[model samples]
Target: MFKPLKGLLVLDFSQFLSGPSAALRLADMGARVIKVERPDGGDLCRRLYISNLELDGDSTLFHSINRNKESVSTNLKDPADLQFVRKLIEKADVMIQNFRPGVMEKIGLSYVTVKEWNPLLVYGTITGYGQNGPWKNKPGQDLLVQSLSGLAWLNGDADQPPVPFGLAVADMMAGGHLVQGILACLVRRGITGQGGLVEVSLLESTLDFQFEVLTTHLNDGGKAPQRSSVNSAHAYLGAPYGIYETKDGFISLAMGSVTELGELLACGPLAAYADPASWFAERDEIKAHLRDHLKQGNTAHWLGILEPAGYWCSDVLTWQRLLEHEAFKELQMTQHVKRDNGAELITTRCPIRIDGEIYQSAIGSPKIGEHNDKIKQEFGGVVRE
Candidate 1:
């Protein structure tokens, strides 16, 4: 089947997560993505520690996000290899790189240089900060962006120190934002036949995620919400909301608002607190009563009882439980990719669906310089693929 980005050439010069992830998205949408790496061990993800699965030297994490692409290792310092890169740039429609601020400029593959070779090239760049910021030269990591953007301060309990988020939120956000920028630029180019530089910064991406907080603070005369524990998210009132411990496991019960509390109270043991307004003055006693009632059964029991009764409740599932969940199967959120070694692993596919089908590509990540011969043949001036 024809895909939206078919026949487009993408030169992927990024490594690790952000740049590679955006390239992978384009590749999955049917673009020809050529990943460039250094001769000394390519992407750091190749050596990332993965304890759960056996790997052939490279980590499964590397393969998980880098499918549907070709890889080439070139020594940019060498004049011959630099010429080869110039040749590839001549034919590429899009170029993606996530390096420290000026690395591309230093390598002579900057937007100014590449556009000279191909004026219609869409150069997408991802950085720690932006091109002209004070923090642009400094190393930026996910944790650093999270901390600097106030994510850590907004997380965790009020009494505890700022807690770090478990996920690489900043990197993922920057990658997704980069994809948006690239696609927008592609549209602009299609309309005007002009290609321009597309830039995404990790720091800006992290701050964008906190738009709700920032917008609220601006709109509400600088009234920032206090950092509260996850359990106390809706407990300011007498409503029974939070993660409740059951006999065997835990369940999230959010019986917030008078109406929701009334609904929960109708379910037998909780029925005594049906009149929330009367117990509004005795909130501590009412919450204690609900907490004591919740401890009588397991998570499954509580979910079965409350979830069906219109109380927004759910079981707190482990990662294993989530993967094996019927919901995952029904949603088709994961896919299996067979490797060159004839082994297969389950990995996430694109979140977007087209024509009721989730688009996927079978091409696994390339070995370091796996496509050197192919790229060399195509762009060597004397030979072509």
Candidate 2:
């Protein structure tokens, strides 16, 4: 209802996750995002599959992230199309790209070049690493950044092999960071009448995401994190901060006093370790007690016991369970977007609320170059170089 970015223009020149995700957020807030893609294949993410699922000949991922946006397919190598796209960039309020370090510079669309073209444009960029580092060009992909940024070391048990996050944590984190920086730049431009470069790297974002634990490790003698041998949830957390198997299902435990938990669950052995430091020093031992005690009952049974007593806990839920729950249904997080051809997609809606109104877009992702003519007519530029 209250579209804050109603008249703003965003030019998304990136592919795959990071750059597109930032554009997606802007589009959610009602920015008119025009995705600039190669004429042949368009965005690579159109086929970058997380699963075998396809919608309207594009992957589910593409539909999910690129919805509520226009597409303008162009051959960047063609001087005519390149000049037209540069004109669009000159008119844009914001621009985003996740190209490798030198690619944009080679094409003359780097931050410096674009800032000169339109001093009011907020240029958002993503890289695998920083601009001038040894690993700058070493693939900006998420999994590689996760492994390289010491992120995999934080997951799973200490005895287990390094476990990377199942999701594209590095890409999404970088995208979020890009959005933050871009919003800050937008604010600066609003006041100063000039825009600034907002750059984020997958490596930088991944490392920043781990700052909480990394800071602790740094202060605590630079020792590496020691994940629990069993029910490992957080690398730095103490006892019971994990998911434990129950008679019927699993339940997760958040931070809470072990003495109160022992009293609530009738875990007799837990009373001995009353001190708070033992929660970490003897974490595994206490978790072992919780593991055994929790397994005696079903997830609901444990939840019933711990919830009323104010102990932080939860039943681990699958997608079906979460979808069926009333609490989740109240959030109204999903939306269905249908194409003119009757093809439809059900995807997550924007997480932000402006003035208590949810941002829901009726527009689905476009068929490649879908808005080419309409946009060319409305934008009224495209002179050939």
Candidate 3:
């Protein structure tokens, strides 16, 4: 339907989440993305799970993130294959890779080389840290970035040790930032008929997540936020912002003002702490009030009572429950698509909506070297022998 990136070509030299996921966004917008993998096991995610059941040729985890693209398996170390890749890069409008610092230069496929071939190409580089920094060469994982960025410190009960968040927040955030940078470069190219290199690092992205906390601490004379264990509110905004157990399940509630808190307490045992402004004035009193009321019922009872009271609340749903959630259904987030192998499985469509339609791309993740011959013929005007 009015796909803006219809004529754009993307060369995806990235693997794993940060880079590949960023390329996935371009693919979603209708760019012709060619995912380059190795002749061996391919993306490391191909061997991630210890699953004894092999449903597809590759691991499902690999398939999940590699959908809507052509897979070309070539050993970049080989001169002939490297030449083929260089030709592809010359024609690409965008090039994305997530190798460690200096790795791209060592391989001779750095942005500088691609820019020599196509000056208008948008080169995107994703890394664990910025191109050069004290920690640039140090290997980084999601967990390490979380801790380095102070997010881990913000998590968990005050008394317990800092716990890492389950979601890959650093990688995901970096991917989003990478996309924004790429789009900006694309826009600039449209105006000047020239492209520039765009870079995003997990460490840099993680720090952005702490903007609110960092800004507050900076203005507050460098006093870091304390890890509070009590049920009391931590921010200047008053209490009633946390997960509470009800009769059947758990629900999250966040009421910032005295009015919203009064509406929430009117539902269940929370009525005792109805006076939000005065209730949290003393830290000890706030904790005691929350413990006494929230423990009265389970999550379901709390949701049924508090949700209708105009309180911002939701059930803490497991994946299965979330799959069946009405909001997900209304949003059309998940879909079932058949792969080339004739098996159907669930996959996620792009989250963004362009106009009235939910963004759709080619269904199913590609098989290894799935379109190698076709791509070789199209790019070089002759298929590889």
- The CA lDDT of each predicted structure is 0.78, 0.89, 0.77
TM-scores of the candidates are 0.88, 0.97, 0.90
Best candidate, lDDT-wise?
Answer: 2
Considering lDDT, which of the candidate structures 1 and 2 is the better prediction for this target? 2
Candidates sorted by lDDT, best first = 2, 1, 3
lDDT of 1 by residue, 61-126 (tens): 788878878888887787877888889899999999998987888999999888889988999999
Residue-level lDDT of model 2, residues 225-252, one tens digit each, is: 8889987888888987998999999999
Clashing pairs in 3: 245-298, 246-297, 246-298, 246-299, 247-298, 247-299, 249-299
Error of 1 at 242 (Å): 3.8
Best by TM-score: 2
Shift of residue 63 alpha carbon in model 3, Å: 1.3
Over 4 Å off, model 3: 50-54, 231-238, 258-284, 298-300, 381-385
Order the candidates by TM-score, highest first — what do you get?
Answer: 2, 3, 1
Q: How far is candidate 2 from the true structure (C-alpha RMSD, Å)?
A: 1.6
* Model 2 TM: 0.97
For candidate 3, write residues 310-371 as lDDT tens digits: 66777889988888888878988877755787766677888888778788754777777778
Better of 1 and 3 by lDDT: 1
